[model samples]
Target chain A: MRTKYLVGFLVIMAAIAYLAWGGLGKSLVYYVLPSEYADNPQKYQGKRVRLGGLVKEGSVQFNPKTLQLKFIITDGVVEIPVEHEGTPPELFKDNQGVVVEGKFAGKVFHGDNLLIKHSESYKPPQQGAKLKPEEVRKLLEEAK
Target chain B: MGNSKRKLTDSLSSFLLLVGFLVFLIGQYLAFKAPPDVQQGYLVRILYVHVGAAWTAYLAFIVAAVYAILYLWKQNPSYDRLSAASAEIGLLFMALTLFGGMMWARPTWGVYWTWEPKLTTSAILTAFYVGYFLLRQAIEDPEFRAKAAAAAAILGVVNIPINYMSVYWWRSIHQTATFDIVNRKLHMDPSMVLPMLIDLAAINILFVAFLRMKGAIAARAAAREEIYD
Candidate 1:
């Protein structure tokens, strides 16, 4: 009886190991750089892929009414046009590292999800950029 | 002698527990008072607790692995109990880290969880410990159980460094280490450092306190079991 139970335990553990590794095998590369996709655009043409790069300067256009955001993501060598339908994260800005998950619609990448890839370094807002007490209160009031 | 030693440990653990909680409150105050991040604003505060819990979990797993090695070498039941206690606390802290991380991720990464390398490795690390407990539950014989558990504990520790280094080694959504120990450099700003350090100290002290208390309880249970046997 003990041997039987031990066998059952081993079998269950083996099954779990298989499933965990099998799932991980597919998503090993979390996101691909724009340059990487440019290298083999054929592979990711129809399939959904996470395109990651820095948001291009002076390319961001957001329509608050329609909730549509369009921007260009570039890796200095390759640039991909992105069309996302949602509010971007507060950290989202020009030259900011971003990952857009979606499929390509012809030339544009229609993003279903947008994420900010922030750096490890953090600093306080510069001296003049610091929010005044009155402005903080006004912002709080607006939030309310 | 044993009774005196037990009393000493009891007081020591209690002292640590008291200090840990007090310092945690102080850490929270400092974290809030610290200037908001240039990018993340208030969201950056979540990392103070998250990183602290993560580091404590790593420390606990390392301690468990060390105790497991000691238990195997000396064949000591006390060492096994201590190892088990440390692993248990480590698992609890790892859970906290995961929960806090998810909360941080939702706002920052736009997803609660992803199959990124750091998150995936952390999930694997947690699974190993869960398996450790399950293996412990399955074994009936005390000697066999301790031996198997010790081996598992030691083996499970192999994932710690891998999990910590996953962000650097692979393409990850998660940021790299704030405290880059390998290069002996702190990546974060000066103002942000003190509060995070305080949080780290608070969590580690609490881990030690909890381990001591849990170890004592396990020792008592073992003693009671011996009497019944």
Candidate 2:
């Protein structure tokens, strides 16, 4: 009876292993920087990938009526234009680090999802150090 | 003396439950009253409960796994009872985490559920524990049931680390670790951290109370079974 139970357990484990192997293989997407992607855009084009970089300053444009968001992701060396449909995440902002998952096509990365990657360190800015509302308004106007 | 010990334990559990409830109310008040995030605004409030419940679920699962290993090693029925109690509470919190996450995600991520690694792994972990409970209920003989449940508990623990590290291990839409314990720093503002810490503490105390109550009930049921035999 003990041997019978051990065999059943082994069989169950084997089946689980088989399923996990296949699921992971099909779902795994590579995480790459903008510079790395720019170096060989054609090589990764049409394949699902996660690109991580800072959102370029003064590049964010959102049309609330259309629910369209356009931004340029930069790694200081290269910039990739990303167009996303739907509302951007709450934490998403200009000059913040972000990771976008989607495929590159037609000279633009079509992002289906946007995730704001906050800094690991928590350092609140000094009082009055943050950008003023007027300055933010000006920047958005300039971007438009 | 035996009756006195039981009375003491009952009083202790009740005290824990009352304290946990008061703490939860305070935490909720603070969470709602805290300043809205500059980026997420009011939506950021969900982080307090969502993150707290997720952390508590992980804690409960770890406790269950540890007790399961002890049961296997010592063949102690008490450890098995503790494992079951903790796992049941873990499942409850895990459900809360998933529900809170979905509600938070709908407005933030533009979708309720995605096939991302972190989300998928969490779902898998929840399902595995559900299976753990079903397995416990399926077996007839007490010894066979305990042995099978312990083995399942041990095996199911592999999913815990997988669920936690899924974000880093793969390209996921889910955010990375919010708190850097090794560095003693937070990824968000201190204002946000305060309420989250309160909720986390409150949920942990509540978990302890629930586990003790559940453990006592299981012990009594086992005692009754032995008497019948």
RMSD, every candidate, angstroms: 3.7, 4.9
Error of 1 at B5 (Å): 16
Using TM-score as the measure, the top candidate is 1
**Candidate 2: tens digits of C-alpha lDDT, residues B1-229:** 2643565258889999999999999999989987766555687788889988999999999899899999989999999999999999999999999999999877665568766678777877787787677677666677788888888888888888888877778876677778764345578877767888999999999999999999999998888788789
> What DockQ would you assign to candidate 2?
0.21
Q: What is the TM-score of each candidate against the true structure?
A: 0.90, 0.78
Every candidate's DockQ is 0.47, 0.21
Superposition TM-score, candidate 2 onto the true structure: 0.78
In candidate 2, the second chain superimposes onto the true chain B with a TM-score of 0.93
Question: Model 1: runs farther than 4 Å from truth?
Answer: A1-20, A128-144, B1-9
Model 1, residue A129: distance off in Å is 4.2
